[model samples]
Target: MISIELIRKNPNIVRASLLKRGENLTILEDIIKKDEEYRSVLKKLENLRHERNVASKAVAELKAKGEKFSKEVKKVNKINDEIKKLEGVTKSIKEEINEKLLWIPNIVHEDVPEEEDKVIKEWGEIPKFKFEPKGHYEILSKLGADFERASKVSGARFSYISDKLVILEMALARFAIDFMVKKGFKVFMTPHMVRSKAMYGTGHFPRGIEEAYKIEKEDLVLIGTSEVSLASYHSGEILQNLPLRYSGFTPCYRTEAGAHGRDTKGMFRTHQFHKIEQFIFCREEESWKEHELLRENVEEFYKVLGLPYRVVIVNSKDMGNAASKQYDLEVWFPSQNVYREVVSCSNTLDYQARRLNIKYMEKGKKKYVHTLNSTLVAIERTITAIAENYQTEDGHIKVPPTLVPYTGFGEI
Candidate 1:
C-alpha cells in the first residue's frame, strides 16, 4: 500500500507510478473525486457537531431565564439527530476511500528502468559437459528419487524427494540458515498458514488469492513464502530498533493460479516447497544498502555452491505492485541449458510498512519503516542446480565442496 498523504500532496508522482506500471491514469482522477467528497463529508460532520453544541447552550440559557424552553429543547434534539445521521454517512465514505486506497499500488523508484529487466552482472561460467547433461528429474530418479511414484500418488509436479536427495535438501536449508544467522539475521520457523489480515498487511491479499491456497473452514491461507510471515511480525507496532533483520524457514504453498502448463515438468514450479527467506526493516536512507546486502548474500550463497548465476534488475513494468525496485537471481540449470529464476530481492521502501502499520520513532516523530526481502535458499531450485551441475558421466552426483561437510558424503 502507498501513503495517501503522498498522493494528496503530489498527484503527478502517483500518476507517473501508475503509468510506469501500465495502469490507467483516469482511475487517479476518480480517486481524487472520491477523496474530495470524503473530505467534504467530514467537514459537514464537524460543523454539525459544532451547531449541536451551540443549540444545547441556547436551550440551557432559556431554562436559566425561567422561561418555557420546549421549542429551544426541540431544536437541540433535531440538531443531535442531524449529527447522528451525518456520522454514519461519514463512516461509510471513509470506508469507501479505504477500499479504493488498497487497489492503488506503491510508487516505483525513479532510477528503476521502465522497459525490460536489465542484467546487472553475471557470475561463473556455464559448464561444458562432454556428454549431454541429463536434467535433474531424469538423473535423480536413477539416484533413488521416486518421482514417477510420487506423480502416481499425488499428481504431477510432485516428488517423493527420498534417500540422499532428502538429506541434500535439508543440508541446503541448514547451510543457508547457519550462514545467514551468523550474519546478524534472527532465525524463525514461521507458521505455514496465516490469516487474511497478515496476507493483506504483507501486500499479498485480494490480489494474491489467485495464487494462494485457502483453508475454507479455518479462514487461513497457505503462505507462498516466509517473507509473508516475517513482514507481518511487527504489524501495528512501533519499533525502537532500526534495521531489524529476520530469517524465516517455512514450507510454502501456491496455486500458481494463472500459470498453467508452465514449468510443469520440473520442481521449478511446484505446489509445495521449502524456503529460507531474508526480511529486513530499516530507515529510508539505509534501505538501498540493505537491499544490496541481501542480494550480495544470495550471490555468495550461489558462489559457495559453485553454481553459475546472474543478477538482473527487474524493470518498473515487471516489478510487482509492492516493490519499488527488485532484483532476480537466475541460476544455471544444466539440462535446461539456460538460467532460471531462483531468488528475488526487493526493496519495497515504505510500501509494506504503511499497510502493516509498522512505524518507528525518531526525534519525537513517527515514520513508516522501509521493508526489503529476499530468498536465501529455495530448496527445490537450488537442488536442481546442484544435481544437474555436479552429476558425473557415471550417473552419480558429486556433492559440492561447501555442502560436503553438511551432507557427510563426497558422492551420492
Candidate 2:
C-alpha cells in the first residue's frame, strides 16, 4: 500500500502513477475525497466529545449542589450519541479509503519505460544448432514426462515426471538452494499455503486473487511463489537488522486464469511448479543496491549453467503491482528461437512493508523496510531450458555441468 501521507501532500504524484499504469483515475479521486471526509468527520467527533465532557462536568457540578441536572445530562447524552455516529462514519470512510489504496499500483521508477520492454543486458551466447532443434516437450518426454497421465489426473498444464526427468527437476531446485545459501542467504522450505493477510501483504490479493487457489471455506490459499511466505515472515515486527536476506524453496500453485492458450503444450506454463525465491528486507535507501544484488545472484546462477539469457527492464504497465522496478531474466529456447521468462527480480521500495505493517527503527524513528524478491530457479522452466539447449544428436539430454554433481549423472 502507498503512504496516505504521500497522497495527502501531493496527489499528483499518485495520479501520475495511476496514469502510467492505465488505472482508473477516479479511484485516486475517490480516495482523496474519502480521506477529506474522514478528517472532517474526525474533527467534528473531537468537538462533540469535548462538548460532552464539558456538559458532563456541568451536570456533575449541579448534582453536587443537590440541584436537578436532567437538562444537562440529556445534553451530554445527545453529544455522546453524535460522537458515536460520527465515529462509525469515520471508520467506514477510512476503510473505503484503504480499499481504494490497496488497488493502486506502486509508483514506477522514472527510468522505466512506459510500455515496451527495455533490454538492458545480455549474457552468454545463444546456442547454434547443427540440425533443427526440438522443443523441450519433445526432448523431455523421451526422458519420462507423462503428460497423458497428468492430464487424466489433473487436466491440462500438468505433467508427471518419471525416470531421469524427476531427478533433473530435483537437481535444479537443489542447485538453486545451494547457490543461494552460499551467497549469504538463510534458506527455508516455506509453507505451501498462506492466509489472506499474507497474500495481501505480498501484493498478490484484491487484484491477482483470480490467479490463486483458495481453500474452500477457509482463509488459506496455495501460494504462487515463496516470496509470499518470505515477505510476510517479518509482518508486524520491528527489525534491528538492516539487510536481512532469505531464500525459500516451495511448491507453488497457480490457476493461470488469464492464460488460456499460451504455453499450453509443456512445462513452460503449468499449474504447479517448484521454485527457489530470493527475498531481502532492507532500509529504504538500500533497496536499489539490494535489487541489483538480487539480479546478479540469479544472473550468476544462469551463467554457471552456461545458459544464454537476456535481462529486460519491465515497463511500468507490465510490472507487478508491488514492484517499483522489475527485471526479467529471459533464457534462450533454441527450439522456439526465442527467450522466455524464467526469473524475475524486483524492488518494491516499501510498497509491501507498509501493507504488512513491517517496520524498522532507524535513527530512533520507525520506517517501512523496502522488500525485494527474485527467482533463483523455476524448476520446470529451467528443466525446459536445459533439455532443449543440451540435447544430444541421439535424442538424449545432458545435465548442465554445474548441476552434474547434484544429479550424479552426465546424461539422461
Best by TM-score: 2
| lDDT score, candidate 1, position 303 | 94
lDDT for each residue of candidate 1 in 238-291, tens digit (9 for 90 to 100): 997788999999999888877788876667778889999999999988999999
Candidate lDDT scores, in order, read: 0.86, 0.91
| CA lDDT, candidate 1, residue 95 | 78
Work out the TM-score per prediction.
0.96, 0.97
